[model samples]
Target: MSTADVTSSTNDQKYEIAHLKLVPKRHIGRMIAAAIVLLILAAIVRAFSVGQIEWSYVRDFLFAPAILDGLKSTLIMTVAAMGLGIILGVVIAIMRVSGNPVLSSIAIGYVWIFRGAPALLQLMIWFNLALIFPTMGIPGLFEFRTVDIMTPFVAAMLGLGISQGAYTSEVVRSGLLSVDSGQYEAARAIGMTQFKMLRRIVLPQAMRVMVPPIGNEVIGMVKLTSLASVIQYSEILHNAQIIYFANTRVLELLLVACFWYLVVVTLLSIGQYYIERYFGRGSKSITASM
Candidate 1:
């Protein structure tokens, strides 16, 4: 290009750049909203600090032996119930998607009944099951009193686990269906059996979809264990209730329970984040490349 033409282009670019003002926009409304929220939060904190609640009771009972035992029971029940739910969910999900009409129908019915009922009502039913069946055992090989066998723990676990299975089955089925049709066709083309395809190819892929909801369910299960308090299951809330009943410090005991619940849920949330990231690595890589 000629020197005159190059010089003219450079001069024009400089003129355009000079006229481009980079003014920052002011968020007046957002600033006002944030200020208002802070004020409300400060008021709440002040009120709680000045309230009649005996904070010492909360501190004292936070690590009490009874509370610790209750916390242990809560954790155990959560793990056991989730394990049962996951196993039942996998089987039910498989049955739901199977070609056999009878199996599919049974799975559908199971989900309908369990998921439709209130969890509290289900717990009540299980706790009181002995009224309907005074004796429960194998026909002749064994016989045991239903009341003796159906403790509060057993009733709570069965109610929570079975109800959780219904919800989890739907989550699993959705995860399985999220796999591409081509994946199934490709597996069959390679002479892979259905179960083998699922175990080796489908389930691994589906884990990415399944992990989130299942993690949420785990958190929900932790809170749901509190419902067992109604059945005299010695979970955290139940023990907290017992303490308050004796000491007449209801709010303080409740605060202690709340504190522990928040701690447990927070820890579980961090674990869920890492697990989701692990399962989502492939998707994240593909996204980054794009």
Candidate 2:
């Protein structure tokens, strides 16, 4: 080609400079309206004198070490329950997907019973297990044989975590299902062992799918920790109750508990966003990095 021809072609090349596009001004109006609504809510709260409580009293005894003790129990129960629930969820999820009819049926029943019953009722029943099955010593097989291995705390853990597992099992099963079947076929075609395929391929993929719902469950578990209060587990809500009972400032004391809960849930939600983003980055549909 001649130099003139090449120069003409190069001159035809185009580059588009990107500019910041603005949203409609009515969107700003909506935002201002939202701000006004929030201000109105704040005014209502103030009008009800919710924040007029003597800050000194709250600072003094409201947040004493004993109050913090309740928060500690809340954390302990939450961690323990979530840890146990995840384990149980994995087991049940696997059972749910198993080829065996009996195993799958049993897992289904387990999920049904727990999900059907109220968690609070379950907690009460567990707490009273000590009364139900007092003791049964076996011959000489073991030291205690059928030992009286029931405590209020242990019972509460079982009730909470087991119930949570039933719900989480479904979440996990959905996650596993969301993974493309072709991935499994490919894994099998490659002669990967079932265990190997599950560990090396399936679970990681399922976990990515599980992130959003599982994050919700984690936050729900944090709030569910309050249920342990029925058994006197001294969680955040329990502490708030103790303070409220002492002073009868129910709303204000409850606000303290709500604050802690809101803080924890907010942090968990932010963590969930990052986790979901991490998994989302793996999506094939996404051409651009987030």
Candidate 3:
């Protein structure tokens, strides 16, 4: 109740508050775990760098003419297959979302068949399609023997493109479905045609969701092109196999192929980052405002 008693109590409280620790406790366990992981990673890097990897052979063949040719083929195939796949995917996704039961069922069946089968099996089937149908053509139109047209290139394209379309259709369908239903209703009320509505409103908004996955699919398509080698298509891995088969430097050739694949995928990943950012700008702005 005295003035000195009150002053003494306030000063004691201030001293206690000032002495309290504010910093978070260091997580010694996490620090120790991280150190162990780094040490293990360093050991693995050192072992591989100094191991019997034939780095000289990898360097020598990295830019070899045959490898370069194979790289070119791989790039071309990836672009062509992805282009075809995306177009088919967009069409199929639209069909799946259409009101007609027949169109939706057809799209669903196509996606089911392609996605259910392994891509390699599809390639084999396309390559050996002659067994099922010696000739392929319109019923009343000119026909060609399946074997005559079913080259490695054709088989690879058909297999990769169709298979990719199945997956891409799902991606596109999800993106489309992510758009608010009210947006569709608004577009319809504004006298927009279905195609015009998709082009101007739904798709542009859905692209923010679609671009990332589509980019991943594009990068995956690059690697998937390697499977064409099974059918003897002259992609990067096929060329690497040819070189190593004669030279008995399999690991070196494989490393070279891996280096190129990493380079291509890295480039693609960078492009994807930029594309995602571009499409995501509006969403980011809306989020920030909210």
Candidate 4:
């Protein structure tokens, strides 16, 4: 190649790289502000706490068998509820976006009702449902009653998941919608079936948008799992509460639970950072504007 042509090509390549690397000012400012806010909050939390705590009691009691059991229960509920929430959210998102009016209405009403109610209240009601009815059975058929159908664990899952689904539906739907309509049209034009198109094309793309917020919810659910304590499900918080109640060290035990909660949330935030990086690949495209 001629010297002039080679020089032109190198300059064009450099220009292309720099153009595609444009960093928006708003994103930069927001990132700096967020970092500063987090640092300030951490410093403030470290500054407080006039109460004296028995360190040995905290160490022994916090990790005692009952607390461990409660931690296990907390983990079990967290996983189960989030799993159920994601599944239900996907279904509801589909229904809300479905072409059928009846299906959309049902999905919308469900989201509205559940999102409007507090999860704790919902949990309490489900646990008390058996008490209210005494015996639940088929209405038209022989009302042959069965045994206790719902335990506190079952009720807690149903209440927490069902309510969470209302919020997650919107998140999933937003993710699905983030994918360009052209992508769907292209999939159909190429003779892809609906299910395959979604699985192979759309969902992969939507997940790039979905995973972040879902991660946020997962972290939130880690704390929200504390509500199970109210139903006497013996989750981490409940176990801690038991210790403090016995020892009359409410603040200290409460601190332990807070510590664990903070640890779990921080771990999740780190996981989310890597997950975002994983989904973040080749989102750029050549356009006429370019």
Candidate 5:
């Protein structure tokens, strides 16, 4: 090509490049949406701050002796119930996955019944079990009046633990199932007993998959303990109810309960994050490298 023609073509390209828009178009709609969201949030905050919710009562009763005692009860119940539930869940999960059909069927039935029933109803039933069975024990061996044994605490534990076990069994079973069949075969080839294999190999690996869901269940159990209040178990909600019933500071008392629940749930969530991180170390390292 001629020098003059090449120069003219280059000048035309430069002119076009200079005239072209560089920046992407602004999203006016998104900006408008964000403004709308911020306004709504501000409005909500203002409404709650000025609403009939007595903040003074919430502040005063937040750490009151009764509320603290109720909070303690809630924490204790949650821990006990979750612990018992985990133990029962492990056994039931094993049974569900076992070779024996009868064992599997029994586990299935337990899960079905407990998971299907309303937790509140289960609590009520346990609390009022004396009505159904005035006495409970081995006929010739020993006997006790149901009312004597099934106090609010016992009833709450039985109801929450048993019900939680049903959900936890499924969580555990899912985690167990996530393991590769080859892992089982390898353990067998190494002459490890099924129990040893589960304890040393399968469970450790499966826990990576299980920890998050189990953590969630633990948090859920904390909230579920509130339901025990229906049976006169003095959990946070029940204590709040009692206070409100006496003083008629219903919303404030409820806010107190809400505050404690959020605090507990937040702590549990933090713990769960650490647990998840610990279990996820191997996978995360590999992912990061990739």
Candidate 6:
């Protein structure tokens, strides 16, 4: 009678355990937060759709001559400014990491002044350089009136390019530092000059570390070109403003500007992804081995 009773009790316990249901955990707070965000986004979409905005104006101006011209100007400035910035940044980065105190100090000061000041202020100062220097050139060889030469485009270029150099130098410096000292020593042992060593051995490797941030900075520069509007450099925003002021289609013109910016940024982001993937190939292989 006791053996039968123990066997029956064990069988019942096992059956109960097998039949027990697992209840999944609910993330109530996460669901509620997501719902709230969706609602807010829906509201914003509805507001814009039903607002007094002239959607037709936005569509028409999106591809208008003025906008296209502005876009061209923006792209030109981006390419030119970034080219200048890269040259300055590389030189400054080299100086920053060099043995000479004078060059290092000069590089530091350049970064300090440019990075410290707002881009707008720099643009204004450049635009108004005639106040500081009536003319610029070699004293006996050539001279030109500062006001004539310092047009809005030139001023914007100098301002944006120089400011970009300050930030890019830091990125470059970090990339250079990330390289192994052993590589530097090896380059030196091979009878390589400093310039030759950096070009042949260092920069190629450092590009892996430098590409991502530099790509991001390029994207940032696209948006930053809007600041040129203040100096009337006729980038998209400035052109949009001119249109809106005349037609009183401010929001529509702004929307047009925003659309173009998003398009350019999206294209740049795709390019950035490719550049990042290319540079990251070596790191990925190393990581896989580990």
TM-score of each: 0.91, 0.80, 0.91, 0.78, 0.92, 0.92
Q: Each model's number of backbone clashes? A: 0, 0, 0, 0, 0, 0
lDDT of each residue in 93-176, candidate 2, tens digit only: 899899999989999999999989998999888877656556545646543312245555676788999999999899889988
Off by over 4 Å in 2: 1-39, 48-52, 61-63, 136-139, 142-149, 284-287
Off by over 4 Å in 1: 1-21, 285-290
- Candidate 4 Cα lDDT to native: 0.85
Better of 2 and 4 by TM-score: 2
Q: Which tens-of-lDDT digit does each residue in 155-217 have in candidate 4?
A: 889999999899899999999999999999999999999999999889889998999999999
Per-model C-alpha RMSD: 4.5, 8.3, 2.8, 10.4, 2.7, 2.5
Candidate 1, residues 43-74: lDDT per residue as tens digits? Answer: 99999999997888888999999998989999
Alpha-carbon shift of residue 254 in model 5 (angstroms): 0.6
- Candidate 1, which ten residues in sequence have the lowest lDDT sum? 281-290
Cα lDDT of model 6 by residue, 131-152, tens digit = 9899999999999999899999
| Better-scoring candidate (TM-score), 3 or 6 | 6
lDDT of 6: 0.92
Model 6 CA lDDT for position 178: 94
Worst lDDT run of 10 residues, candidate 2, spans 141-150
Residue pairs in candidate 4 whose N, alpha carbon or C atoms collide under 3 angstroms: none
- Tell me the TM-score of model 1: 0.91
Clash pairs (backbone) in predicted model 5: none
lDDT of 3 by residue, 59-154 (tens): 899999999999999999999899989999999999999999999999999999999999999999998899989999998888998988999999
Per-model lDDT: 0.93, 0.81, 0.94, 0.85, 0.94, 0.92
Tens-digit lDDT track for model 5 on 1-290? Answer: 99999999999888887766789899999999999999999999999999988889999999999999999999999999999899999999999999999999999999999999998899899999999899999999999999999999999998999999999999999999999999999999999998999998899888998999999999999999999999999999999999999999999999899999999999999999888877776686647956
Cα shift from native, residue 18, model 6 (Å): 5.7
